[model samples]
Target: MQLRLPTSIPEVQECLADGAVPIGGATLVWAAWQRDGFPELAVSLRELPEANTIGAEELGAAVVLHQIDDRVPEVLHRAAAGVGTGAVRRAATVGGNLVGSTLRCLLPAAVVLDARAVVLEPEGHFETDLSDVLAKHHLLVGLRWSAPIISGYRKLDAEAGGPPPFVVASALHADDGGNRLRVAVRDGYEVLSGTVACAEDSADVLDTLHRTDLGTLDPTAWETVRRHVTELLTRSVGG
Candidate 1:
C-alpha cells in the first residue's frame, strides 16, 4: 500500500526492521501478485541508491545482479536479461531474485560464483554466504559473488520451441577459485543444487535432471527426455 525508498544501508535496515518489505524494481513481486496476492509493506530501491552499480565497492558490498548490471554487462547480465523481457529487467533487482526462493536459477549461479551477502539484523550487521543467507533469512538487503573464471548459462523454454532444459547447467571454471556446478529446472520450479568439480558425466546429469526430486516420472519417459537434453547440452559444449 505504501512505498518507502531508502538511500542508505542504515535507512534500508531501519525500514526492514519496521517490517517493510524491501523492493528492487518489484518484478517478481508483481508477477507473483498476478499469480498470488499482495504481500505486505513495501519499499522500492529504484531511487534509493545506485543499487545497480558494480565495482570495487560491489565486490566489497557483495554485488548483486542489478549492481553487476550497473557496472558491467557480463555473463550474469546476459542471464538476467534472459529472465523475461526488457520491461521486466527494467524493474527487477538481483536481491529480489534471491529473496523469492521458489525461483532458484540465478541464485544457484550466484552460489556457484561464490557470491556472498551482507545482512542487517537487529543484532548487528554481518556477512554470510548467499546460499546460507537465502536459507536462513526471510528478508535480504543485497548479495555479493566472486567474479567468474569461465561461466555460461543456457535456458530451454517452450517459446524457444525447444524442450525445456530438464537441467539448466551452469559451469564455472573456478579451479583456482572454487569449481562449482549448478543445475536447475527451467521456469524456476525444479532445482538440483550442488557444488562439485565435476558431475557423474553428462549422461548422469541429464538422468538426474529427469528424475525430479520425488522420482515422480515414469522411467521410460524420463529416459527419453533425459536423452534429448543430454544431446542438446553435448552439442552446446561441443560447439
Candidate 2:
C-alpha cells in the first residue's frame, strides 16, 4: 500500500485521476479494509486540501466530526460527537461518513439542510445535493451544506447494539426562503428514502422533518415512532 499527501485541489485532482482513493481518517475504509483489500494508493487529506469547508452557514461551517470537540455546541454537533462511540467519532470524518454511507443518521441531516456534495471525480468536479448522493452508492470526495436558521437531527436505536441507523430524520429552515425536510429508513443494507407529510408543510420546517424516521429502529415499529416524532416536532416548530 502506498500513501501520498497533497495540499491543493489540483494535487487532489491529479491523485484521484491516478485512481488513488482519498482517505480522511481511514475509519470507514479500515473497517472494511480486509473485505476489499488495502487501497493501492491512500491519499490522506489531513494536510492536503481541506474539504470540511462545507459549513453550517454558507455551507462553510462544516468541521470534520472529529473536529467538533469544542468549536460547535449545537445538539446536532453533540449527536455527531457521540456517533459510533468516542474513538470512532473522533477519527471518522463527515466526508468519510458520506462516502462510505456508514451512518444513515447523517444522511437525513444533510438532506434536511439541503446539503450539496462536491465530488472530485477523475474527469472533473461536480456537485450533487446530499439527498441525491445518499440515494446512491458513490465515491464522495466532499460535502457542502448551506446555513440554516433552525436545524435539528433525530435518530432511534434498537437494543443499543445496532451498527447503523434504523430510521433517521432531519429538518432545516433556511432564512433564504424555502424550507427543507427529509426522512430516511435503513435496515442493514436496504435503505428507504421519503419526503415529509404534506399536511405539515407550513409548520416550522423542523416539524416537517420530525415526521421522518431516524435511528436503528425496526420497521414494524417505525409507524408508531414516526407519529410520535411528528407530533413532537409539530409542537416544537408550532406546526
Candidate 3:
C-alpha cells in the first residue's frame, strides 16, 4: 500500500484524486487493518493543519475526541465524553468516528444538533446535512452547527463492560416562542431522526424499526428506548 502525508488541503485533495483513502487518528484505521489489511492507497490527513481545527461551532476532521471541550454544545460534549476511555479517546477522531462507524457516540449527538458536514468529494467539496455524512467517495473536512441549541443524548447499554446497543439524542430550537424539535436514534448501522411528540410517535418509530433494518432488536430494547426518549424530552422541553 502506498502512504501519503500531505501538508495542505489542496495537496490532500490531489492525493485523494489519485485514489488515496483519507486516514485520520488511525484508531479505526488500525482496527480495519486487523480485519482487512491496509487499503491500497492511504492518505494521512494528520499533517494538514486545516483538518485539526476545533471551536464552539466547528470541529475539523482530524480533531481527536479528546480535543472536544466546554466550548462545544452540551449534548455533543456529553457524547464525546462517553466515546471511549482516556487512552482510546486520545486516539479517536471526529471525522473518523463519523465516516468509519455508526456505533461511535458522536453520530446521534451530531444528528440532533443539526450538524453540517463539509466533505471533500472526488468531484469537489460540498457541505450538507450531517445525516448524509456517509456520502460515497467523500472525506469529511469538518462539522458545523447553529449556535445556542438545547439538546440531550443518552447511550443505552444493558450490561456493564459492554458496548451500548442504542443511543438517543434530541435538539430543541426555539423560534418565536415555539419549539422545533428533532430526535435522533443511533442503532447498530444508521441513525434515525424524527420529531417525537407523544407516545404514538414513539410507538410508530419502534414498530417501523422493528419491521425494518433492526428487526432483530429485542423487545426490551425498544421499551428502554421509549422510556429514555421520554426522559430526554421531558427534561429538555421543560427546561
Each prediction's TM-score versus the true structure? 0.63, 0.70, 0.77
lDDT of 3 by residue, 1-239 (tens): 88898887678879978989778778767866878887889997777776777777787888888888878877788888888679978988888888886466787777767788888765777888765667563688888887545777777755665655677776766555555566667765566666532333445544553454334445765565566656655666467
lDDT values for all models: 0.53, 0.55, 0.72
lDDT of 2 by residue, 1-239 (tens): 89877776678778878888767677767758888789888776665444555334322212467565433224346456546767877777666666564554455455555556765555676787665665664446565555544444455556766555454444444343444444444455455554554344444433544444443455554664466446545654674
Best by TM-score: 3
What TM-score does prediction 2 earn? 0.70
Where does model 2 exceed 4 Å of error? 31-37, 58-63, 69-79, 131-139, 160-165, 174-181, 185-193, 196-239
Alpha-carbon lDDT of model 2? 0.55
Q: Is candidate 1 or candidate 2 better by lDDT?
A: 2
Q: How big is the positional error of residue 79 in model 3, measured in Å on the Cα after superposition? A: 1.1
Please identify which of the two predictions, 2 or 3, would achieve the higher TM-score against the true structure: 3
Cα displacement (angstroms), candidate 3, residue 165, comes to 2.8
Ranking by TM-score: 3, 2, 1
